[model samples]
Target: MTSDNKDRLGSKLHDVEAAREDQWARQRDADLLEKMRERMSKTACPHCKQFLVAKSEAGVPLHVCPAGHGAWIDAPALKAVLKEQK
Candidate 1:
């Protein structure tokens, strides 16, 4: 094949790779947004009145305040934390 043909093929391959990367990035961003929405729907902090973010500590699910206020752990999670201490 001629040099010009090889150059065109290379450019086409590069464009295809860039398009694939862009698609993957968009999918990742969409997944992150869905996770954030789920977390926001969980509950809000009582003290700070802001939406709590879901977190796991020592295999316990906890809703933590984003404003440095406090965390909300369910009865089961609280029991788990207490058990871990002993």
Candidate 2:
């Protein structure tokens, strides 16, 4: 192949690789979030032993104890909530 054609092929390959990596990362994040949701749904409040209720405030997702025991915010959600407060 000519030099220009070879360079174009290399660039296209790089773009394809980057797209694949992005897709993989998105899928991995989705899987992790799904697992977290499943675990959270099954979790009971430490103090009340009642199933925690899914909730959101300031667009931050969290789990609140049905018995008014307390709330649970994952690290990412806590960070988002705190950021929004400021």
Candidate 3:
């Protein structure tokens, strides 16, 4: 293969690897957050046993517990961030 082609291939592979790593990191973080949320919700919220329910108020998705003590995960935050687009 030509040097230019090899360089392009290497760059593309690097980009793909970077993207995949980023996705994996975000997923791992999400999993951790979910576990933490469940533990917190079970101890904090009276309504939710070990999970926070997603609710929407005017389009902003919120991960709120029954007792109203929970955190916003990445998806919920993304939804909130997109609120301005709507």
Those runs of model 2 whose alpha carbons end farther than 4 Å from true positions after fitting are 45-58, 64-71
TM-scores of the candidates in the order shown:
0.47, 0.69, 0.50
| Total residue pair clashes for candidate 2 | 0
User: For this target, which candidate reaches the highest lDDT against the unseen true structure?
Assistant: 2
After superposing candidate 3 on the true structure, give the runs of residues whose Cα lies further than 4 Å from its correct spot.
44-86
**Winner of 2 and 3 under lDDT:** 2
Residue 14 alpha-carbon offset, candidate 3, angstroms: 0.5
**Which regions in candidate 1 have their CA more than 4 angstroms from the true location?**
44-86
Per-residue CA lDDT of model 2 for 1-86, tens digit only, reads 89999999999999999999999999998898787778898999888798888887666778889889998989987787778789
| CA lDDT of every candidate | 0.80, 0.87, 0.69
Clashes of each: 0, 0, 0
Write the residue-wise lDDT of candidate 1 on 1-86 in tens digits: 99999999999999999999999999997896576558555677778678888777776666788997987776765897889899
Better of 1 and 3 by lDDT: 1
Residue 64, candidate 2: alpha-carbon lDDT = 88
Clashes of 1: 0
Worst 10 residues of 1 by lDDT: 33-42
